[model samples]
Each structure stands twice: as structure tokens, then as C-alpha cells.
Target chain A: MSEVKSKIKRVSALKQRGKVLRDTNPLLAVFQWGCNHMMNEAELVSDQPLILDRDFKAFSKVQVHNQYYNEQELPNKFKVKEYCPVVFKSLRHRFGEDPADYLTSICDGQIYGGKSTGKGGGDIYYTHDHRLVIKTLAKEEVASFHHTFKQYYSYIVECDGDTLLARYLGMYRITVHEKETYMVVMNSIRPVGIPTHRLYDLKGSKVDRKASDKERAKDLPCLKDIDFEEAQERLYLGGDTETFKETLKRDVQFLEKHNLMDYSLLVAIHDCNEQTPGEIDRDVDVYHVGPHAKDLKADPKRLYFIGIIDVLTVYSTRKRAAHAAKTAKHGARAEISTVKPDQYAKRLLEFVSSMLA
Target chain B: MSEVKSKIKRVSALKQRGKVLRDTNPLLAVFQWGCNHMMNEAELVSDQPLILDRDFKAFSKVQVHNQYYNEQELPNKFKVKEYCPVVFKSLRHRFGEDPADYLTSICDGQIYGGKSTGKGGGDIYYTHDHRLVIKTLAKEEVASFHHTFKQYYSYIVECDGDTLLARYLGMYRITVHEKETYMVVMNSIRPVGIPTHRLYDLKGSKVDRKASDKERAKDLPCLKDIDFEEAQERLYLGGDTETFKETLKRDVQFLEKHNLMDYSLLVAIHDCNEQTPGEIDRDVDVYHVGPHAKDLKADPKRLYFIGIIDVLTVYSTRKRAAHAAKTAKHGARAEISTVKPDQYAKRLLEFVSSMLA
Candidate 1:
């Protein structure tokens, strides 16, 4: 009788344990599930030295059916599509990110939704460690990403992942209840354990380029070009200036060649003087210190994290029409967000150059 | 103001979600976590066709630290050790199990604890689908497993996974609060969606081989030799009799050569008349049907699952002492559980042959 009682207690305890794994956000839960699944599947694949042309078009899709008895707190059925797995895996290798560590950061712990949504109206999330960012993308943006992915991969390989462009880690499409959501994972431009005193999203455009009144009301608003100019903000890269400028020039030129434009230079400034002395996670926060921080002439009070983001947008016909109207109204010399790729790249480089001290 | 309010609501909702992932069973949670982590790490390894001697000794150990900010509902610190990964992986392949599917079966769903513990005092768990069984092992059993692992791997390779031996899938050691527990994963002998009307753990011994009163009180008690004899149970294998006997002979010889004894033949009988018509999962329940079931003089109402289990126990010094003491007490000719490997095998084969028709 005592043994039977103990057995009953254990079985009930397991039932209680099962209840604890319930999904709070089904979408995020599915996304994490897909990541864990695909990453494990990728282990069986043999390593290839060269990425094949067909690899760019390749994808793995799985539809999961959750049975009644299973403990998975997911929808009854959902589909996950991983695009260009080999290409993305190579990109991850190029970025020096360990696949295991990447899996742990995204799937092993909580994923927190961003307090504010992206300008593109996509939802944003951060890993528990704040080492990676996940952003939902529009269908057209996914198409645009596929269009530029080949050149983008080649550029990443050539640059050895040293450019200031966003380090894209993985791309996936998740479908639940017939609704499809495309998401991209990237290294977070902000470092952990450091508070950013000021942030700027620079597009080299002055007209309507300042942070909105509503945006400014937030504790850490993304300030813009006009705001940057208002504060006369400058980055003291010192000896690292030439290397930084050269990489930016090459990156923008590559984007121009691909007819990509309207990308922003996201700069986060951490005031070293204000923060308590602590060890910085250099591996995760790769952009925290410039390569030549030990070369002297460094600003002891400020540490900077800088990267180019939103590079997926292309200068389409609609953008060209908007540019023509803006040019007609404000004269051809007027600084605007939308312009020819060449002119946009040149203006961004010049604007960035002015910020260097 | 509305945006801020919405953001607050979202944050609070997420907090509520995090609270839902609380751990009711920290040990099981950690086991699941470790499986996910290790399986993912295994994906990054290059495949090898040949299993080396060192592969048996090889192991991977990881210590996980769950910080306050992380959502992992585990102890603050725990250690997981995976034993003979490459060898086990090869064994899985030999058994025609996909690594990815194996990972998903254990990690993607809830693992239920058995209603009754094993006679060895080990806790038992089954995958949500009931396709796999996980049993906690004593430290000595783990050591015994390692001792025979090389010969076991060779035997498995030679027989090509066709023998009626337990299909060992994975073994792991988990540590929490400075305490260690070893666990092994194996294919479940019983078929899914089929009702087993009678179960038996036969060792060809009458002395102390009968199920206890407590065991007999269960819904599905594991009967013994005395119980089987009293009921006059027989297996009508017909055409499969020779093949079954041949395989059993070879398996017993293998065990005898390794000085192992005290193993049992686990037999589960599913009475078709007692079960509802349903498709049996053949992939998971590989032992459900006999090799020559079509040529079977078999009972239409009965389907059998038979496998050799508990084969890790070696006839060591302690067992030799127990054999002498038992022989002295019950007379040398008594059908006892403990005996020399050669005598034990002969007695078991003779007892099993008598029940075959």
C-alpha cells in the first residue's frame, strides 16, 4: 500500500512537472524549437570547403505535429524553413561564432522581446545573454536578402568578417496557423554589461532625420543624423581611423554595386568613466574596443560599438520616384534618405568622415 | 503614452510567461537540458566510419551554470557527462536509428517516470511516445557496462543488430549538488499502441524467481518461471523457432564468454483479441513480430516481443560467493538465479526450449 502511494505521488509529480513547460508565446517557442531541431540536423552534414551555387537556393523545411501525450507546449502543427543552411553556416564560421555556443545563447535560455518594435514594423527579440538579436522580416525583404546573399557571402569571406556591416548569423521562416514569419538572426551591436550613454542611427541625411519627439521620450532613444549634428558628436578612432574608413568605404561600395542603399550607421557610445570597473565580454561584444585601442590617443572615458545596419533594403522604383520628388522640391543638392546608390554611398562616407577626430 | 503602456503590458506578460517555465523536477529538467546541449555539440563533429579503441574510453563532460537572468529552470550548477559518444552513435546507426530522431524523441517531449521502480532500485522513465526507455544505473553497473562495451560493440557489429539483445542507445552521468546518477537509454521492448496482456521476466530459475506479492498486485505484473510453468505458457514460433533459438544460443555464448550471467529474457505478449484494431509503430517496436510471422503456426490472438535484458551483470567475485552460499543452502541441483555462466546458459536454454512449440 505504501509503495503504491509513493508511485501515485511520483506520477502526479511528473504531471505537475509537465504543466510547467507550457508555452507563454507560441511563436517564440516554435522559433526556438526549430532552431534546436535544425542545428542538430546540421551535425550530420559533412563539412565542405567551398559553398556551391546550388547551396544558396537550398533550404530545409520540417512540419512538426505535436501529439496529445507529448510535453511540448506548442501548436498542434507548425512548419519551420531554414534557408541556405550551408551558406549561413559558413558565414557563422567566418564570424568566429561556435555553433554550439550560438545554439545555447538562442535556444537554451529565455528570449526577451524588444521594448520597442523596429521601424520596418517587425518584432525584435534578444537572447538571454544579449549576444544576438532576432528580427522579423517582410516577404519582400526576405526576397531581397536572397537576391544579395551570394555577393554578401562572398564579401564576408573576402573581408574575413572584419567589416562594420551587420553580422548575420542565421535566417529562418516559421509558419503557424497558416501565418508565415521570416526572421533573421544577427550579432547584437550593443555590448553586454556596458550602458550606452548615447546612440545614433546615421543615414547622412539632415531633412527629417532627427529622432521623433515620442522616440526621444524613451530612456534610450535611437537618435538620428540631425540629433548627431546638434550634439556635434565625433568618434575619436585615432590610429584606427584609416582602417575603419577603408573598411566602411569598401562595404558601402559593395552595397552600391548591389544597388542597396538607405542603410544606417548604428553607433553606441559607452561612457567608461561612468561605468564601474568590470571585465567586458570581448568575444560576444566584438565591437567594444577598436583594434588599436592600445596605440595611444584613445579616449579613456568613451568606448564605442559601431556597425552598419538595415542593409537589406534596395533602391526600388518607388524609392526612385520618392527621390525625384524630393529632389524637385528641395533642389538636387538637398540631403535625403533615398538617392542613387552611388550618391548615397558617397554621402554616407563623407558624413562618417566628418565624425572622425 | 499608448506605446509606453503597451510596452509595459508586454513586459509584464513576458514576466508571467517566464514564471510559467518553473522547474517542478530539477533533475529531469537538467537531464533534458544536457541532452539538448550535447546532441547539438555532436552535430559539429565530423563523422567517422571506424570506431577506435579510444572511442570506448572517450567522454564529454560539461558544467552548466544557470544565472538568475537566464530562463533555464535548472539548479544553479550541474554537471553532465556523456560516455562513449562515437561508439554509441555508431550503435544507433547500426540499429537504424537517426541521430536527429533519437535526439528529438528524448529532448523534444516529456519523459514520464514509471509507476513502479525497477527491482534493482533504479528509477525508470519512458519517452512520451513510449518508444524508448531510460533507466538509472548504479555506479557499478556503469563500470560493468564499460568493461563489456568493447566486446559488446564487436558483437553488435557482427550480428548486424538482428539479435534479440537490448539495444543500448545512450548512457550519461548527471551530477547535481555533488551527487552523481548514471542513466542509460535503450529501445523499449513493448510495441506502441498494442496492449500487452501478459509480461514475463524469465531467467529459467524457480528459486526466488517468482514475482513478489507487491509486484503481483500491479496492473501488469512481471511473472516468473514458476508462474509461467503454473499457467503452462508456451510460444508457438513455428518457422521462426530455429532462427530464434540460434540467435539466443549465440547471444548466450557471447554472454558466457564474457563471464556474464543472471540475465533475463523479457517477454511481452499482446493478445490481439484484447486490443483494439490499430497500426503498430514497427520502427519503434522492432521486436513486435517474429521474422517468419507469415509462416507462423502462431496463435492469431498473440503477438510477442522478446529480448535479452540485464546482460551487463558479470559473474564476478561477489556473484561467485553468492552462488556458493545459495548452492550450499538450497542443494547444488536447485534451479537458482545465480550460477556459473556456462551452467546458467545451459539451464536457461533447456528451460526456454521446453516452452517452445
Candidate 2:
């Protein structure tokens, strides 16, 4: 009788544990499921020496059924669409990310930070290790991504994944309960272990480009171009200046050619002097040492991690309308952010160049 | 401002809805995940003309990593092992189950009935549509299944899935949070649409064979051989009597040859007269018209659906000891259920034969 009682107790306890693990957010659950399964499946296919035109358009869609006992916490039915798996796999390879490690970082543990919303109304999340960022995308943004992904892939290939643009690892469209969520996974700009003392989103615009009071009240506010200029901030790259400028110019040219605008140069500054001893995880925070760190002019106080983000937005009719409105409001020569792609790229390069010491 | 507030409200509402769907039971979730994934994958492979010896031992294992945000309600890590995919696929094909329909049935909807516990301490679940039963298995039972699966597959092939034995659909071993749960999916013996008026688990034994008071108190208790004897029940097969007897003898002989014992003939009686109009779903309740329903001796009042279950148990040393203990307690000639396979099968046949009218 006692054994039976204990057995029943154990069973109920296990059941209770299962109840706790039930996925309350099935959209995220299915996204993870899709990534894990698709990545594993993608890994099984041997690497192709040359990228095919068809690869850019390749997508895998799966409809999942979670009926009856199986429908734990997830919707009884849902769908996941993975876009450009082969291209993303190639991008991940070019970016020097081990597929297994990337998978582990993205899908092996709990991801944090869905509370923070992006400017595009998409939720932003970070992997527990902070090596990657998963940003939800609006449907139009997903359309924009699909529109420019081929050129994006080509650029990444040409640059050998060394440019400042966000390193896209994967993209997926998850549909749960008839609602669709587009998400893109990319390498985080900030180093995983380092504490950023200051961050800025620089688009070379002076008109209404300051961070909001609400944003300024945060522990680490993402300031704007005006904030950077007011603070008299400058990056002391020493001998790496020319290489950085060349890469920046080339990336800007690529974006300009594609008629893309409204992108920001995301900069994160780590005050090395303020960091505690052994606070850095070198393995995870690979960006801590800049390219040509050894050639730096003995300014040991700070390190910077930077990347270009929000590059998916094109200078389409929607942006042209916004550009016209901003021009009228702030005057045609107000250095407004929503300029044409050519003017946007030129002003951004000049502003960024002035910040180099 | 109102628009922003409404958007926030909508987002919060979606999040709340997601919270409701969160899976608390990771074990069942993973089981469902594994089944849904593996079955879909199996369907993609073209059918093999012949089953090789290697196919019998073939299995697939997947290790899932659910780190950070991806971890949601699932454990950070878990593993799923699918055993004998090819053999099971073959078995399913032979059993006249459409692979696509089977997948949809198991994974597309909510599976019900994890509350009922089988005698082996395993939880029994029914598919939402009641076409299948999913039973959790002990590790030993998994081993026992593996031991006899080759013969089982061969027997299934020889009989062409026409035997009265329980139809085994799929088997899986799911490991979550370091705990392992083995599960088997099979066709439910009882008809789906028709309500069973009485159910019996007849093992042809007089000792300790009756349903307990607690079991009898249930809405539909699984009565035993003693209860059946007490009720003086009989099956009137009429023109189908000889054919039914032949099938029973053949099935018993097969079990005996394999050293299997302690199996039960599960009987469910559906009273047509007591059933509500339109209650019977002919499509789902395929068994309503038994194999020889037309020749069922002019019995318009009742329909019987019967099958052999618990056939995985083998007459090993453990069972031999139980047989000896029971024989000593009840005297050598007693019709004990725990006897050697040959004796057990003979006695079961004799008892079943006596019920034929």
C-alpha cells in the first residue's frame, strides 16, 4: 500500500513538472521548433561548392498539428516558414559561426529580453549568452528582407562577412492561431560579457534625432546622433582608421546602390578601466579586440563594438513620402534622416568619418 | 495615443492567450513533438519493397536544445529516440492505416485521456477522435517489445494485419529533464462512436481476477473473468463461430510459440437498442459492424468489438516464479493466469470457446 502510494505520488509530481514546462507562448515555441528541426535537417545536406540561383528563393514550410494529448500548451495547429535556409547556412559559415554552437546558442537554452520593443514595433530578444539577437519583423519588413536578401547575400559573400552590417543567421515566419510573426536572427553588436557604458544609434541626422526622455531614463539608453555630437564622442581607432573607413564606404555604396536608407550605425562603448578583473568572457565576447587592436594608439580606456542595423528598409514610395514630409517640416537642407539613398549614404559617411580620431 | 494604447492592449491580449497555451507537461509535449516530426519525416521516404534485417534494429535519435528564450516552458535540453521506423512504417502500411491520415490524427488535434492509468502504472491516452490509444511504457516493457518486435513484425506480415491482437502503430522513447518515458501508440480496441455498455478483460483465470470495488464503482469498469462467469455471458457469432474460433486458436498458438503469456481478450459490448439515434459514427466506428456482422446470429440488440491485448509480456524467469507461486497457492490443476505460455494459451482458448453460442 505504501509503495503504491509513493508511486502515485511520484507520478503526480512528474505530471506537475510537465505542467510547468508547458509552453505558454506557442509562437516562440514553434519558432524554436522550426529553427532546431530545420537547422538539423539543413546540416544533413552536404555543402554545395557554388550557390545556385534557386537557393535564394528556397524556403521550407511545415504545418504542425498538436491535437489531443499532444496539444500540451501549443496551438492545436500552426505553421512555420523558414526562408532561404541554404543562403543563411552559407552566411553563418561565412561569418565564422560553428553551426552546432550557433544552434546551441539559439535553441539550447532560454532566450531573454522580449520585453524590449524595437522601433519597428517588433519584439527584441537576446540569447541567454548574449551572442545573438532575435528580432521580430513586421510583414512588410519580411517582404523587404526577401526583396534584398539576394543582394545582401552577395554583399556578405564579397565582404567575407567583415562589413558592419548586421550578420543575419536565419529568418522564419511563424503562424500560430492565424497570426503571423516574422523573425530574423543575427549576431549581436555588443560583446556578450562586456558592460556597455554608452550606446548610440547614429544616422547622421540632426533634425529631431534625439533619444526620447523615456529612453534617456533607461539604465542604458540608446541615444541618437545629436547625443553623440553633444557628448563630443569619437572612436580612437589609430592605425585601423583607413581599413574601417574603406569597409564603411564599400558597405554604404552597396546600400546606396540598392536604394536602401534609414539604417543606423549602432555603436556600443565598453569602458575597460571601469570593468572589473575577469569580467570579460573572451570566447563569447570575440568583438572585444577590434581588428588591428595591436596597432591602437595606447588609449587603453575604452573598446567599441559597432554594426549597421535596420538596413532592410528601402527608399521606396513609403519612405519617399516620409522624406517629403520631413523635408517640408524641417526644410529641404535640414540634414533630415529620411533623405534619398544617395544623400543618406553620403551624409552618413561624412558624419561617421568626422567621429574617427 | 489611443491607437498606441489599443496596440499595446492587443499585444498584451495575444501574450495572455499564449500564456494559456503554454505546455506544463514537457514529457508529453516532447512525445508529441517527436511523433509529429518522425512520422512526417518517414512519410517523405519512398516505401521500401523489402524490410532488411538492419531495418529491424534501425532507430533515430534527436537531441533538442532549448536555451534562453527558446527554453520557454521546455527543459533546456531533452532527447527523443524513435525505434524501428522502417518496421513500424511497414506495419502501419500493412494495418491499412493511411500514413498522412495517421499523422494528422495523432498530431493535428488535441489527444485526450491521460487520466486513466493502466494496470502497469502507465498512463493511457486516447486520440481526440478516439481512433488510437497512446500508452506510456516502462523501460522493461520497451525492452520486451524490442525483444519480440522482429517476430511480431513477421507475424503481422504473415497474418496481413487481420489478427485480433492490438494494433501497434508506433513506439518512442522520450527523455526530458533526465527522466525517460517509453510510449507506444496503438489502435484502441473499443469502437470510437458507439458507447460500450459493458467491458471485460478476460484472462481465463478464477483466482484474483475480478474487478475491485473501486474499479466497479467507475462509470465503465473493466470487469474480469470471474465477473464474466458470474454474469454467465455468451457471444452469439452464429455462422461466424467456426471462423472466430479458428482465428482465436491461431492467435493463441502464435503467442504460445513465442513464449508469451498473461494476455487478455478485451471485450466491449455496444447495445444498439440503448444507443441514441445518430450516436454511431459509421466511419469512425468501423468495428460496429464486426468482421462478420452480417452473420452475427440475428442479434440486432448488441455489437461486440474484441481484441487480444497485453501480448508483450513474455514467460521469463520472473513469470515462471509467479506461475509456481500461484500454482502452489491454488493447487497444481487450478486455471491460473500466470502459467507457462502453452498452458496459459490452452486454458484461455478453452474458456473463450465455452463462451461461443
* Separate DockQ for every predicted complex: 0.02, 0.03
Please report how far candidate 1 places residue B234 from its true position, in Å.
0.6
Clashes of each: 1, 33
lDDT of 1 by residue, B1-357 (tens): 111111101101000011111236566666775676555445434457688887887776666443221223457677787888778778887887666667666655567774343456678887667778888888887888899989999999998776877888889988888889898988877766566799998989889877888788979888999999988999888678898899999999999999888888988887767766565543444343322111222556577788888888778777889889999999998878888999999989999999896
The 10-residue segment with the lowest total lDDT in model 2 chain A? A7-16
The 10-residue segment with the lowest total lDDT in model 1 chain B: B8-17
What value does DockQ give for candidate 2? 0.03
Computed on alpha carbons, the lDDT of every model, listed in order, comes to 0.72, 0.71
CA lDDT of A211 in candidate 2? 89
Supply the TM-score for candidate 2: 0.53
| Predicted candidate 1 versus true structure: per-residue lDDT over A257-323, tens digit per residue | 9999989899888776677766554344444332211121255667778889878777887678988
> Highest DockQ: which candidate?
2
Instruction: After superposing candidate 1 on the true structure, give the runs of residues whose Cα lies further than 4 Å from its correct spot.
Output: A1-357, B1-23, B114-118, B277-297
